[model samples]
Target: MLPNGDIVRQVLLGEKGVCETVSSDALVIDMSTIHPLQTDALIRELQEKGINMMDAPVGRTSVNAIDGTLLILAGGTDEQIARARPILMCMGNELVEAGGPGMGIRVKLINNYMSIALNALSSEAAVLCESLGLNLDVGAIKVMSGTAAGKGHFTTTWPGKVLKGDLSPAFMVDLALKDLRIAVDVARKTGAPLNMGIAAESYYAAASQDGKGRQDWSALLNQVRQQAGL
Candidate 1:
């Protein structure tokens, strides 16, 4: 795997590159995390020259890589994936078929987007907890572990609420907004950098403006989807 799309392009399609060194029969597997559109374009270019290619971006960290237990997200035709499986298995223990051509990188991009952003949000929460004189382990971690705060909305609130089309206000958006404003106010007073919380406040504020304040907090997903015309 290379660092990014530009480097991958340089090594695979540039002067005296893989095209010159490898035969058309060689299957080029790209495990780099790159733009999905770039992955699609590269695959198309490779296929034009009768070269087989697959986007097989791996998941997990370097420790998993060293242990040969990474999760491989493979994007290619079934035949191509079958031919590439043994080679991929050498690097990863699990393989997920992420649809055709460029999907592996697409999934990887989405996963990283959520994870990287959440890292910042998590830091904001940690700092707020510290400023409140709460013990990080006993007060924050232990308390949030069983709730949506730590377990994540996807597995906690979402399934029973908006995902099921309920939106019946198990926790009202207005109440959530009120609580969020309080937290944001506290963070500011404590000199904590809660940028994520500030950004989230705007979304909840928008939801309230859209007359969704009485709806369940999970309905924010629907509000966002509607805003995106999705």
Candidate 2:
């Protein structure tokens, strides 16, 4: 009963399926990543037949699964989730009760959106370095990773540097523009149009041509502020 969302719906609602087969004491847990709305509907359907269920989706590598270290995000009531904890713990090293009903899958979707976007952004950073004929070394990665573009980065930190007019080179304007150019090319090749990314690229290009190429990339924010009369 751990198929995808569509198949789960078909099996549960299909003729003489879970609705008919499940006893009053049965507590069926579904481990599928699906739309919250659909999970809501399924919950209602299951309630009609006195069958309890939980949306408990799992993530991490296949190796993690084999090692019983997957992270499980679950949605259900306190009692229901408590009942499922022993089983969940056996399959995962971490288990989060993401709230009631469809909340688990909803959280997963939001997490997926950020992770997906970050991957592209990360790739863009690498491509930018390549285009600038810069070496993609560990220190470069650390610098980029320290910005808002990666983990352990702080938006406040970058903004602080810019506001204080600290234009020292953690990364330079020409380098930033080069990365954005490669990011744009990557997006185009993947049939993904990057509207804001392209605009940022333009800003960095202008800054570079204005003899700011050697300055910190964050200095481009100053250029933007000047244009806006800020």
Candidate 3:
């Protein structure tokens, strides 16, 4: 319910805060979408005082909240989460135990990162479509909805390719870079800002330069993971 980590900290652990009144056996479930590190720190502080805590940030929209069908990304020990499940179910229908403490917020952060970034990317594409005189509804949305363009790489490309440990070129990285370059060029010429497209071109260009030109476009995930030492 709190806006950010600072407010949550002040209200929970600051001078004359509620932590002083909380019973040791009471479980504190933080439903805020704050920094994962902050969540971990708060949980540790509460645990030191013999107070159990769980992070259960909900997903979906306020509409889902009204319907009690939100997706709850929970993080805690199995026993701790089990004790909180019935209470959580009253709000969210789908409860995913993301991992141990701090993970719920981690997962939520990643989800939001992708979703929020894609929102801007999607807008860029829509503007490009307009600049190209393409019908946004029929020419773009209708076509993209059935393909990886709209359905997303996670469900389409990654599952069959990189996620399976197969990097064989279904759609080669070189070809992807080429296509992206074309789009970026056209967007620039049409006076449409394709900031996301331009940024994506850099990633594809690097993958190609790393001798992954023949690999599947999904291989970028593998390339990134390797770079991260994962």
The Cα local distance difference test for each model comes to 0.92, 0.78, 0.91
Instruction: Give each model a TM-score.
Output: 0.95, 0.67, 0.97
Distance (Å) between predicted and true CA of 182, model 3?
0.2
Which residue window of length 10 is worst by lDDT in model 3?
A: 220-229
Query: What would the per-residue lDDT of candidate 1 be over residues 1-230, giving only the tens digit for each residue?
Result: 99889999999999999987998689999999988888998999999999999999989999999999999999999998999999999999999999988889988888889889988988889889999999999767899887888888989999999999999999999999999999999999999988999999999999999999999999999989988999
In Å, residue 110's CA in model 2 sits off its true spot by 0.9
Better of 2 and 3 by TM-score: 3
TM-score, predicted candidate 3 vs. hidden true structure = 0.97
| Model 1 lDDT-worst window of ten | 138-147
List model 2 lDDT by residue over 13-57, tens digit each.
Answer: 888777777778877788887777888899988988778887888
Index of the highest-lDDT prediction? 1
lDDT of 2 at 51: 86
Off by over 4 Å in 1: none
Best model number under TM-score: 3
Better TM-score candidate (1, 2): 1
